[model samples]
Target: MNTLYFAYPGELETPTGGYGYDRKIIAGLEDLGWQVELVPLGAGFPFPAAETLSQAQTVLEGLPAGAQLVVDGLAFGVMPEAASLACGRLDLVALVHHPLCRETGLSEDEASGLFESERNALGHARHVIVTSHATATQVADLFGVAEERITIVLPGTEKQDFAARGSSGKLKLLSVGTVVRRKGYDLLFAALDGLRECDWHLDIVGGLDADPGCHAALLQQLSGLGLTDRVTFKGAVAPQDLSGFYRQADVFVLASRYEGYGMAYTEALAHGLPVIGSGGGAVADTLPDGAAIYCGTEDTGKLRSALKLLMTNESKRLDMSAAARRAAEALPDWRDAAAQFAVALGGVRR
Candidate 1:
C-alpha cells in the first residue's frame, strides 16, 4: 500500500525546476518510508506529438491495476481520455505545478483547449498536489477543482553555504530558469541594455534545449542590444557547477512573467544573494519583502531601476543579501515537503 508510481515526462534528473521538484519529492517520499517508482512518459510533454501521447497512455495503462499514480502536471493536464479510461484500474493523483492554460506563449484557442482538457482531466483525479497557494487557487477557481481536493506543498530549499562574493569590481548577476519566453529573457536583456554604463556581467544558467525558437529569438535580441560580451549563456550545468555560479554572484535576477513557486528565487536566497525580479504569481509570495527588489514584468524602466539600485548601491545589495539569508532560513527542506505530499496521498488512500 505504501508503494506508489511517479509518472513524469522524460528523465527525472532533468535540470528544469519542475523536474528538479519531482526528483526531490521522490527522495523525500522515500525517506518517509514510501516506495516510489518512476515511470517515464517520454518527452515533448504538454505539446507532445500524437505518437508520444499515445505511448504515454500505453505506459500509464501498463501499470499494475490500482497502482497509486502521482502524475506530473506537464503531461497529466492533457490526458482527459486516458484518465477517464483508467478510472476503475488506477488511483490517479495529479501533481499540478500550474495550470497548463496559463503558460504565456499560448494563443486564445490553445489556452482554451488546455483549460477544457485540464478541467476534464481533474475530474478524474482523486487529489491534486500543487506547490503554492497561488497554484492551489488556480486549480480550484480556474481549473474547476474543489478546495477539498487540493493540497499545497511548497518547494523546499537546500541549506547551502553562504555565497562569499568575490572582489571583482564588476557586478556579477545570475539568472536561472529554462531559456523560454515565459521567463521573460527579452525584458531582462532590454532592461540591462539601458544600464550599459555600469560595470556588470550577467550569467544566465539555464537549459537552451527546451525551446529552440525562444532560444534563437533570445540570441537575436542579445546581439541586437550589443550584449554578446556582457551576458554569458552558461546553458545548463551540473548542480556542483551551478553552485559556483551562485557563490560568485553579487545579485540574482530573473524577469519571469510567472512562476508556480519560483524554486530559483528560493535557491538564490538560500545562497544569501540579493534578488531582483518581477516576482510574478507565486514568486511574489515565494520571496520575502526585504530579500528582493521586484518590478512588473512589462515595466522595463522599473526593472532597469531595480537593477541599477542593486548594481550601483553595494550597501543596499548587501543589506538585502542578509535579509535573503534570514528569509531562506524559514523555508521548508525536502523532508517537510515530502511530509506534506504524504498527507495528500494519505487522503487518496482513504
Candidate 2:
C-alpha cells in the first residue's frame, strides 16, 4: 500500500532545516501520489513531559493494524516503550536526522542516556533513513543498527541563480543555522575577529531561541570582541526573505561542529556563493572539492585564514563560486529526494 503516517514533534512550519526537509519531502511524496498523513506527536520531544510521552505512546499503540509508520528520531528515540510496542503491529521506519547523543552542550550522563535510548529505539525500526553517509555509519557503529537496514537519502536543493555581491562597500558574509553551541558560532566569531582589518559585514540568519544561553553568550561575545557593529543577527526569516539574503551574499560561511547533512551548505552551493567552512561532521563530504575552503573545526587561526583568503582574493572566490554552481548541479532535487525516500520505505518489513 502507498499509505504511511509520518510522526514528528513540533509544528511542521518551523524554520529549521530539519523541519524544512520534512516539509519538502512530504510535499514531494504527495505529488508522487502517496497517501502520507503527518502526525504531530508534540512539541517537547526528546524531553517531553511524562504525560506527553504517555499520550504519544497511546497514539502510536492505537494506530490501525498493519499500518506503515515513519517516526522522526527526535520523538522516537526517547519513546522506546512505544516503539517496542508499535513495531509488533506496524511496519515502523525511523527517520533520523542525526543521533541525539551527538548534540552539543549535553552532560556526559545525558549523552549516555540519550545514546542508550536511541539505540534501544532504533532496534525496533523495520528500516532506518538517514540524511548522509556519515550518519548511516554512526547509526550502524554507534547505535548498533545494521548497515543493511539503513538508507541515506540526502536533502534536495532548489534552483538558484548565482549570488551577486551587494552594492555595500564591505563584503557580505552569510551564516545560516540556529544560534546554538553545536553550530560553532563562538569559534566563527573568534575567527572573524582576527580578520577585523578586512572589509566585511556578517549577516547571521538563524533562530536565536533554540539555545537561549548560547544566544545570550554569542551576543555578549560579539560585544566583547568589538564586532557588534559588523554583525547583524537577522533571526529566523521566511523562505522568500532568506532567498533574498542569499542573492546578496558574497561568501557563505558556517563552522558547524557537527551535522547530519548540512542543508544550508547545499543551499549556498545552489546559490553559487563561494564557501568558507570547517571540516567538522559531514560538511567536508557534503561539498565537492573546490566548492569550498575548509579549515579545522576549532582552529580559529585556520578559519580566519580561510575567510581572509576568500574575502581578499576576488579571483579565487570567483573560481570557487563557479565550482559551487557546478556542485549544485549534481545534487538531488526535491523529486529525486522524494523518490529515494519512497524506495527506502518500500524496504520496510512489517
In model 2, state the lDDT of residue 58: 88
Q: Which stretches in model 2 have alpha-carbon errors above 4 Å?
A: 163-168
- TM-score for model 1? 0.97
Per-residue lDDT value at 60 in model 2: 90
What is the lDDT of every predicted structure here? 0.89, 0.88
RMSD of candidate 1 to the true fold?
1.3
Clashing pairs in 2: none
User: Tens-digit lDDT track for model 2 on 1-350?
Assistant: 38989998988888898889998999999888999988888878778999999988988987899999989888989988899999889999999999999998899999999999999999988999999998898999998898889999999999887655433568999999989998999999999989889999999999988889999999999999999999999999987689888888899999888888899999999999888777456887986789887776677888888898988888888888889999999999999999999988877744
**Residue 102 CA error for candidate 2 (Å)?**
0.4
For 1-350, candidate 1 gives per-residue lDDT tens digits of 49999999877888988988998999999988999998998888898899999999998899999788999999998888888877668889999998899898999999999999999999999889999999998899997788998999998899998765544799999999999899998999999999999999999999999889999998899999899899999999876677788888999999999999889999999999999888467977776899898786567888899999988888888889899999999999988999989988988873
What TM-score would each prediction reach against the true structure?
Answer: 0.97, 0.97
Q: After superposition, how far is residue 25 of candidate 1 from its true place, in Å?
A: 0.5
RMSD of every candidate to native, in Å, equals 1.3, 1.3
